[model samples]
Target chain A: MVDENVSFEDNLKELEEIVEKLEKGDVPLDNAIEEFKKAMDLVKACDDKLKDAQDTIAKIVNENGEIVDFDVE
Target chain B: MVEDYITVSKVTDYIIELFRSDSNLKHVLIKGELSNVKLYPSGHLYFTLKDEESQIKGVMFGAKYKLKSKPKSGTKVLIKGKIEVYKNYGNYQLYADEILKDGIGDLHRKFEELKEKLNKEGLFEQDHKKKIPKFPKRIGVVTAANGAAIRDIITTIKRRWPLCEVMLFPSLVQGERAGENIVRQIKRSENFNLDTLIVGRGGGSIEDLWAFNEEIVARAIYMCNTPVISAVGHEIDFTIADFVADLRAPTPTAAAELAVPQFKEIRNDVDQFNSRANLAINKTLNENMARLDNIVSKKLFTSPGEIYAPKEMQLDLTVNRLVHSSKSLIMKNQNRLDLAKSSSVFKNPGSIIKAKKENYLLQFSKLELLNPLNTLKRGYTLAKSEGKVISSSKDLKSGDELEVEFNDGNVNTKVI
Candidate 1:
């Protein structure tokens, strides 16, 4: 799997597929362990992405694309 | 063709003469509802004035009144004007020099008319609505910069879908220019390449939210290629923009909720998947281990000589059957021979042969007594001539020389 640039939903879908594949028990023993490890990493990654998020609103009319000061009603 | 025909100028002049001289057509007051109101950039009012029966084309140039906006659509108005014929179109129209807003008594009627017109044009169709993306990386918000509408949308989107970047295109929410400005901002947001857009304002009176009802704003919302969500003033006030937009959220806060999903919910889903993966792998391992344990427990497979023991038993059974059958066959044949030898035929063979030999000797002796050589020995005198014994006297001849032996020998003789 590509490590970067995937959206949360896309990444989550892949994680779900991995879990399902592991659950079906068709994978070899070595592959099953490896798949389990990958799933753990994805869980951690998703959690981190959510925790690191911050909300920002920016104005695009200016050159810097910053928040232009306006009267806050 | 021109024998007695009236000129085009003459016909136009006669119509103008009728309009100018008519008492009611000059400086007359007419009461009706207004429709299709438009305020031009030059501050001139252009619209149609109509009652239920009919409508008249009209305009009030900017040179006359200088005050607030041109009368909003659906306003019952008393207009004083003179009917004048346009030389270009050859149609008489009212040139309203004075317009007074009697009252805006038919707002619902005006709303229904515009809605019906737009609906007939297929603006509110389901097919025209676009699906909001489940996850948006960039969202453009077309709303006033300072109000609770923008603040709520930004906060809600950030809380639920934290990765989304909000681009604000500030716009006027109410005024004569509000609808036009909203259209301008929506058009300008196209450059941002937004995944979705929310155009809304906080709660207000219907007249206060009238900018959203403007056709310019509705048509702009209809024509935008981007998916738009209209979150207007209140739950009860439904505007034309709400119908034309891809989705209608009751309030600005609700629009943010609709735009993005909850982040925590998906994390829980992933956790469930993680456990299920573990459960499946463990199940396979346990089953295989059980199968191996079962196979190892059987003594037939685990120990040596298990196969050889059965084969030895089968060999012993076959050898015993062969020996028993051969012995019984020899004994049966020997008993039959012994029984035959014990019968009377062989034991009495000598007695029977002796009796038969004695009978043979008696018959031989009788035969010897009847032989001719025996008769010579008894009493017969043999006269001999040559080798014959003469029986009759006539048989002797003079001068014969003879010798004779009766039974045992003969003597030679000659005839004389």
Candidate 2:
């Protein structure tokens, strides 16, 4: 399982590695199926992480576009 | 003995009065080169006045010493005062009330002497000098708080490095207490952890810069771990502090400039580095992406399995044809073999043998019609003599033995 607590940059790096491996296309059929499943999961994870960051940033900016500090959950 | 038969106190008083009332000795101007001059802690001055002929001891009490500037050994000066007698030591000394420089002043001599001494000690050696900081976060200045020099330093530091913090330690730059004050400020600035120290004041005579020239101030600067920059007086002016400091600037403004680097220039350099790095990374990424695009557009990537498709189809077709033709050829050959087997004449050997036997029997019947034995079966007799059959009368001879054979019996006969 990927650690959600990892920094966004680290997660992005891992995602890039996954994409590169999939692009190489030398995996065995069974391994390829497994990698494909993992890639799908990683894509969703990255998307979720980005969406969470965007929402947090948005919350920081009010309708007037003024920055404000907020507490973490 | 009778002339000296007076009380000791009275005699001493009389002698002191005689010396004090001497007109030539009182308020007289004496010219000589000064030597062994000392300014005592009591604020009194003591020295020996000497000439080519003789020497005389002189004393300037605190009252008069305070009224005039301090002098040192080898100073050529004229003193206006009275010649007085010391009854205890029985010595005559000059009590100077006024002193003036007849040639070079004693202060200058002392300045030169100290300069020479320190120079020989290698305190002014260039190898000991340290480089001033290019950028100082905070500048520690040791000067009179209200002096023009401090104001100038602050203004220059603000104009050059606005972000830098300026701290001041007020000190008396001239006087007997000046050296101690300057040293104290230097130590205090060190405790404050100032990035750089500017210890100096505005232009002045050698007397004014005397504090900086003092050994105490020099030692303080030398011991300070923080970088020290001395800006004393004008460009031509130098002091002991200057030699001991890390750097010497001509003026306070120069010191400020030396201490702080231009922020704009640094910002420009940083921006340039960032832009160059970004361009390099972008170029790298673009090249990598172009290579990836080239690989993706290649035939192998379009359909990775297409390379083997033709061979696989060829194999499939060949196998099908082989199976179909092989089955048909096997059936055709089998049919030909069955037809040849069914029509074969040599299959029944016993029937051929029987047919041949029947043919032989018919031939034998035909042959039997010509047989003489058959005639004998029809009641005709055959005679023979000596195993010979007689067929005609000519064949029979008188002496011949004849035998007659019937179908069922044999008979013997003689013919004559």
Candidate 3:
């Protein structure tokens, strides 16, 4: 159950592994196609993460609590 | 009225009384670097506090010692106490009650002590340090949100890779309560589900960056489940946080760079993988196709027509031989009939008619000899049962109903 907020490193690593397996060329055609699809998805996920990045400025209000915008500062 | 000159001791006493009477001189906070530091056998400290231009004598009674580290020569310190004039020496000195190692030296001493202790505890061991994520979805920063550190980090991450979200856990970077605040923020960062954490502060004197050097903040960075990148002060300012962190970045911007990758290079890498994938699949398909070609080119498929041609010719040859055998028999019979007609029957027609009549009479007499009436006259009787003549005894069952017909009479009986 991978979520929407997967880290960039994990996604890139999965893409790398898939590409490696694909490059080895030992897998059957069907499996190679599946690996190719997975690689493309990871690349797209990484690209989307970069594209969707937003600027955020926040401050800790409590000892272990939410990050509120430090608008006053 | 000319004022008379006072004695030297009397004048020095007056100056001392004036210094003691002044509140500013009695309770003061002074910042300076120490020089000529000495500890007496009687448990007293003597040092000169000096800045670039001036120097002042300082003294701390042995009873007033509250320092974790003894002050050394050239140590920067902040001294608090009253100014006193030693009448005999005719020199004024700062009688210190509290001596705090100031700026770089004071915080640095504490930083080193904590680093040594934590290192022995294996907190700084390589295996204990988690690898900083190469690609981070969220980065938690424990620093002032409005400061240059946060701004630099944000800008660097955005420029290199924009997909990552930067979460700032604003904390006090300096002052008496700064270490507690930084520790608090680091603890809160655990809830962020971050891939990497950057705990740092901007460049300042050691006093301003002291929070990063504190043991509480260093331990907090060590215990974090998420990988930590410690970036404090300038390139030369090392802190305990840096030593305990998974990675040490010389500056806040460098921390951001360490946590994420540049987008352009990643895209190029993915493009290479795409081409490699195509080549691999095609290579497999081409190899399979060549194998199929090798099989199809073998003699089995190359000359299929010639392989079946001999069998077809053998079937046709058999049919021709069968037709010739029947035709040859009919022709031989025709030749025999022509020879017989010319030599015997056509030339002796009258003799042939007589012989034919005689042969017919002989065949009729022979037929008469095989008649059923002659057998009956020879005392050969015929019997029938159930309109069927039984020729063998084995044909009859032991218990049976039988009807027997003899010559001219019929009888019914149950066989024994």
Candidate 4:
């Protein structure tokens, strides 16, 4: 499953591998269909990740060694 | 005599004027080693210029000039200043306007020495360099809080990969204590779980950027678990931190760029992979379907009977031959049998034998009829010339000799 534990890079790598295997055209029909489904799921997961992205504000470590939000003025 | 004596204040003023009026005392250049250097909060620098035989107090107003080389206690320098007396202390000091470093300066020598030592220790080896993550979730930057370096890093990271959390560990990036301050900040960055750390500052002179060349800062960067990108100065400026860091970006912006991939590129990659997968799967499905169609279109499946229709036809012909081949032969023989059965020989055997007797009697009678004796009995006579019988009367007249023939006897007679 494509979740937080599996990084986006890993998910993408898996997706690429699945696509490569499918392109080789020797896979059994049943396994190919199953892998196709898995690949689509991975694509959707990646699309969701890209769409859900939000910019995070920068933070700073203060003189007292405390972490706080400090935007660049 | 009491009237001639002047007040101490007046005498001090007079001395101050005398020292100022002396042309030789004004605008003098002196070369000596700096000692007891002090920089006040008021931006004034005071130090002692001392030689083996003599020493003097010196002051350089900070606002007047900036020194490329920061002079410390043991630094040799040439000072251009005017000798002036302070009324409050009743002492004269060199009021410096300009201070030039006498040689390459201690900072450069120290930088070279530390660089050589660290190189020998193999801190800059390629094997020790850590790989920066292609997609970092958290990036830490250690630089001056209010400097261009921090701003550049933040802007670049935000513009390129905004998904990552950028943490700034601002520290003093110059002066004597800057090295320790930067080390502390780097150590602090470890707790934040930074995937990459950018430790640097904007461009400055050799003396201004000296903190980065410090051994403590270099070792700290080397020891940092997170991959460190050192962006100490502009492209031309190289620092010890740059050598020890996992990656060396020419500037802070470059450091941030090296830390993470561009967001747009990643998105493009995903989209490309998605389309490629789609095309591949579609092609696979199409190819498989085509193969199936080819197989299904075969006579074996579409019309199974047609597959063996010719064989079936051959079998029917064989069966017909089997039935008719013997039947026709037997029918022909039966027809022959019927022909034989319809013949008189098989229908009336006794009559055929009686007919055979009568035929023999008739043949005998005909044979008897053909006999000349029977003709003689009918009173028919035959004449012969020599041994030949004469059928014509002309041949008998011409014959010289003739024989009169009767059914029972023959007699010789003369033709007369």
Off by over 4 Å in 4: B1-105, B306-416
The recovered share of true contacts, given per candidate in order, is 0.62, 0.00, 0.46, 0.71
What's the C-alpha lDDT at position B295 in model 1?
82
The numbered model that scores best in TM-score is: 4
lDDT at position B151, candidate 4: 91
Measured with C-alpha atoms, the lDDT of residue B281 in candidate 3 is: 66
* TM-score, one value per model: 0.52, 0.42, 0.55, 0.59
Q: RMSD of each candidate?
A: 20.9, 23.0, 13.3, 17.3
Instruction: Rank all candidate structures by their lDDT, best first, as comma-separated numbers.
Output: 4, 1, 3, 2
Residues B210-314, model 4: lDDT tens digits: 899889999999999999999988888899999999999998888888988888998998888889888888898899899999999988998998779899999
| Most accurate candidate by DockQ | 4
- Poorest stretch of ten by lDDT in candidate 4 chain B: B63-72
**Model 3 Cα lDDT, one tens digit per residue, A1-73:** 2346766667777777877787777887778777777776776776666566565443444445655654422
Q: Rank candidates by DockQ, best first.
A: 4, 3, 1, 2
lDDT of 2 by residue, B1-416 (tens): 78868887677888889887878887778999999998888888899999998999999888333443477688778888889888877788999887776743666777678778878988777787766665555677788766777777766655555656677766888879999988987887776667788888887656678898888888898888888999888777778777778888877777777777655554443344334434444454566678789999998989878988999999999999999999999999999988888763558778888899999999999999999889888889987768877778888877777778999988777777
DockQ of each: 0.34, 0.02, 0.37, 0.50
| Model 2 global lDDT (CA atoms, 0 to 1) | 0.72
Runs in model 3 deviating more than 4 A are A1-11, A37-66, A69-73, B1-109, B306-416
Candidate 3 accuracy as lDDT: 0.79
The pairs that clash in candidate 2 are: B383-B403, B384-B403, B385-B401
Query: Could you tell me the lDDT of residue B99 within candidate 4?
Result: 84
Better of 2 and 3 by DockQ: 3
